[model samples]
Target: MKRILLVVLLGLISHFNFAQNPTGDWYGNLEVQPGVILPLVFHISEAEGIYSGTLDSPDQKAFDIPITNVTYTDTNLSIAITDMRLTYEGVVRSNALIEGTFKQSGLTIPLQLTREAVAIEAPNRPQEPQAPFPYTVQEITFDNKEANATFSGTITLPKVVFKGKKKLPAVILISGSGPQDRNEELLGHKPFLVIADYLTRNGIAVLRYDDRGTAASTGEFTGATSADFATDAQAAFDFLKTHPDIDASKIGFAGHSEGGLIAPMVAATNKEVAFIALLAGVGQPGDELLMDQGYLIGKAQGFDDEMLRKNRIAQEMMFTTVKEHYGDTEKIKEKLTIYLENALEQNPEMIPEGSSKEAMIKREINTLTSDWFQYLIITDPRPTLEKVTCPVLAINGSLDLQVPSQKNLTNIEESVKKGGNTDVTTVEFPNLNHLFQTTTTGSPSEYAILEETFSPDALKVLSEWIIEKTK
Candidate 1:
């Protein structure tokens, strides 16, 4: 009887080990909000007891997100990738149920997974039309030792009718803040496509691609800084000059938002660039801009001057603290933990009640703060503008709240003048928001609802300017 019992126990233990491996397909549903079900499918595997898989989000139309370093011990499972890390501490009962919480982006959200007998299929959607550029889109790849990765992008050009035809002028489109697709436009806007179409139609080639680590490109986007992005832009410019259809002498850059900053960096380095266009680019450093943004957001939400002042102080303190201890992460974290507690006790109203300090700190750190903010606060775009020997067109919308046009464009104009670049032109479109949408009131909320395509006026102005410059 004792021998039989031991055999049964060993069999049970082996079964449990096999069940917990988390290999094969696992289907789950995410509750983003009440009544909102986001279907998720994960293909999990184990390599030396580490969990690895790809996640597919049906609701987001996102698929094949590579997940690595996944591990499960008893009821607890955790996964970590380069930028995203998630831990699931829950039970797997009867070899089917996986109920737990998934921690990501500093917030812990509930997640449930179950082994499905049938395979889950994501909803099918029609593909977007290929770019209408006359020239074939070519893939360009380059290595950046600073970012420690190889970055790649697509270069679209005008079709060459014959050889020795004057080399076509080109522009490199830089994306804004966020994980932008190669086009740099989402939500049906397809701004890159629209811009590429227009520019290529006007005999100008354009290069636009997924910001490093997005789509087919390599590298970690979340961990990168503006200077890192500038390196990628430089690589793109270098690639363009080598193309047979491109005119090495007339190349320029047109960047939007953060991309705008990158444009100047490339132009500053490459004197061969003929011109540059700052399309709603930031003129000030990131930390200052963030403070301004917070204040504006507070004001828009009807916060009084005193409240705004207090919040600004808190933000500034946070920036200084983070910068001071950037390299010493352990000390920075310890100080931040203490500082956050004190901050909450002193100014409970600054952050929402019941919000986790850990979550806030996580959100505040990473590339956005550590790298981008640090670079922005220190490096003045004006130096790049001054270094630029090419003509420049800086456009901003009067209603843009993200990078307030009044201050940014004014700074640009002043900087260009100081740099002695007389060819610089600045334009502000009234009632247009950061995305260049003309609206009754320029607000971010309006962007989701309005889809008029790239502002025709803006496109016309851009095309005309390019034509005149290339001519």
Candidate 2:
């Protein structure tokens, strides 16, 4: 449950009379959240008086994103990536400086562009394996007939194949949330790639794929719920069962974040699933998990008690309304609208500085009633875990704010045990954030800055556990 940031854009200086050559590279830092900063670079070029450019978010490992529109007149400059619904409007303050506002979704943040490049050192991910490796890697695709979706992925087979012994045990790596590629790449780190490499090197086969409607996979991701993603994971499991190199009896799921939720859902009814390793998986109801997520992250980020209280009130009301009127879009919207109207009446500060109260209410209602939001807010994972009889390993970072360790881990073990399944193991790694990276405050703002991709101790724990289970 990622926290949403909404704030009004501040005023910018007036346009100057002199025109600055907006060519070459322009750099800036985007204050995406309160404490998170994403460094952006715009590579602009002029062709016969027509300007075109590309944007790069280096921290996110994104590069060469097309800038569909660019207009430079006098001292005013504007650029838009229509596909991303991202726009930047600025006034050239000098030959080397431009003050602007970066707007995406419904939130606006101030951004300043400058000619001097910001020094962003590449993150050091020692765990990420290089090519020409010891394992056999293959690019592949599997189809989900139910979803009518084709998933593109990489399958790594250990070099040490069993001649007369048992077949290779395999696990499908599932990503958390968002439009993730096969690597589960984020913040310049490829956790899946590293995991696949380590496990394959340790003689366990690994299959990691892009989510449906993400990257090379074919399907619509938007409006799809966790249930839909479970079908996709099931499709992956089915594919591995028929593969020549994989042992059908030893196949399992290793999911991170939301993927953790999907793993239990798949294993609940599918007795064939060998085991499941949940990484920062949620054990509580979706609504409760989200409320805790908001509160924990807010507190970690130093949000005032009053602000946190209001946010909790807003989230609680919205989630409760959605759950009560589950599927009744009109009723949910009406209830949320009224609730927000009352909230804003009591706390005028809830309204964004430059936004109208009605507009804010409408936006909040629309988000809370959205298809994915509704599904996430209403789903509970404990019941699914209770039905799962397979071996379960639920692990989390003690400092993780996204899915706090103690609450979720306890629920996971108890739920599985309550169903008469005793093959459950849970561990809480201290000082680690959501991604398993050792951190100070465990704030997401620290994710990109810190270089250690996936913690080596975590990798060792995961690989050793899988080996023991498979053996």
Candidate 3:
């Protein structure tokens, strides 16, 4: 399981006065956890009077995020990011160094920045939509009474001239885990945005939204689990069902990763969900998925078998601890801590720097006890897939390491077909990563550097399958 790390605004020094104009790529590393270094890049540029720049976390695959309010007076430098409620303050040590602290979500970490390069080239995403899009785009809002929250999203309809008010088939796009914007923006690539554009251009109506408590949506993001997010998707379905231009019988759901799991959860319970398209969705229980993820990713990263075995054992024990302490949140944390500490004592190298066994155990405890992880560990999509009688399409990238393509696709298809759902289709595209982007190595780190967002072939398959089902 990955430790939860917050992304803070990367700062750059622009010489407005005595300070040497450090207008270039400044690089730093944050110890997100023991031995794990997250690379952060800040590109500073000076035009006239405006200090405009962008931030990129190469490790996270997030790039060109706008950093605002850049003001630096000599050694005293302060950068503020209003969107994330974060600020970075530090001192410029010389012509080449800046030492500072990154503050976000009430957590602070020391960061030392050095001039990495003169300039860094941004990733090329030519698939991103330009002006004069061929789809009719409209911003819309819908309310989910169960969570007492309102969601904001965009609906894209094919631009073809219809004979009167045609009832077009529609699909609601659900993003993977984490708080995502309407486009499911990640690493410099907006996969959902590309997919929505592709589907809408192909004459399929599409709805994609910001997660509750993310972007323009309201409610708490930290405490809500995947099931809670499913309700929001259901609400989107309800809204689409009543749209004046949408066909009630052709409305469907297209979910990615965790969103794929949620698609079945909603589809199984709500008969109105006509179909579902799962993209890199998991078919096993949440806890098992985590353990598998750790093993595979560790293997790819060149971790020894012994190290991976220890990881798996710790994961299994953690799951057991949580299961045993189910509803007792406080006690669960305590039990999980003891469990992990014991595991770490047995394996010393597993402990990260700047973090003792106790600290590592505490971090794991916090994550395992959260509403999301707690719910995720126990939630199984197999039963829900079995109950989903609607036409289903499950696709995974051959290079997808997070959700192994062969295992998950086979299991998901089997589960659906076992339920007597004969219309299920599963496909795995070669050389594509979790985001369906063509890559050399399907590593998560490769996600941002790759210029291609969503694979054209994947988009074609998804849009065609969705269109065929809606028909």
Q: Pick the candidate with the highest TM-score.
A: 2
Query: Candidate 1 has which clashing residue pairs, if any?
Result: 51-70, 182-209, 182-210
- The parts of candidate 1 lying over 4 Å away from their true place are 1-135, 139-148, 160-165, 300-307, 323-331, 365-369
Better of 1 and 2 by TM-score: 2
- CA-RMSD of model 1: 7.3
Model 2 CA deviation exceeding 4 Å by range: 1-89, 93-97, 100-120, 162-166, 352-359
Give residue 119's error in model 3 in angstroms.
8.0
Q: Which stretch of 10 consecutive residues in model 2 shows the poorest summed lDDT? A: 4-13
> Relative to the true structure, how large is the alpha-carbon lDDT of every model?
0.72, 0.87, 0.83
1-471: candidate 2 lDDT, tens digit per residue = 122222221112222344457788899988776545679999999999999999998666578998878999887899987556578999877878889998875569999999987664555777778889998998999999888899999999998965565689999998998778999999778989999999999989999999988889999888888899999999999999998989999999999999999999999989999999999998999899988999999897777899999898888878888999999999988887777888889898766544557767766776777788899999989888999999999999989999989999999999999999999999999899999999988998788767788888888889989988887
- Candidate 3 residue lDDT tens string, 1-471: 133222221123333236566577788876544434567887877777566678887644467887866776666667765554456787878768888998764458898889873233455789998869987899999999999999999999887733554689899999999888998988667888899888888889999999998889998888898989999999999998888878898898999999999999999999888899999988988888888888888887778999898889888988978877777899897787766767778787886533456656756777789888888888878888999989999999998889989989999999999999989999999999889989877888666667799999999999888877766
Residue clash pairs of candidate 2: none
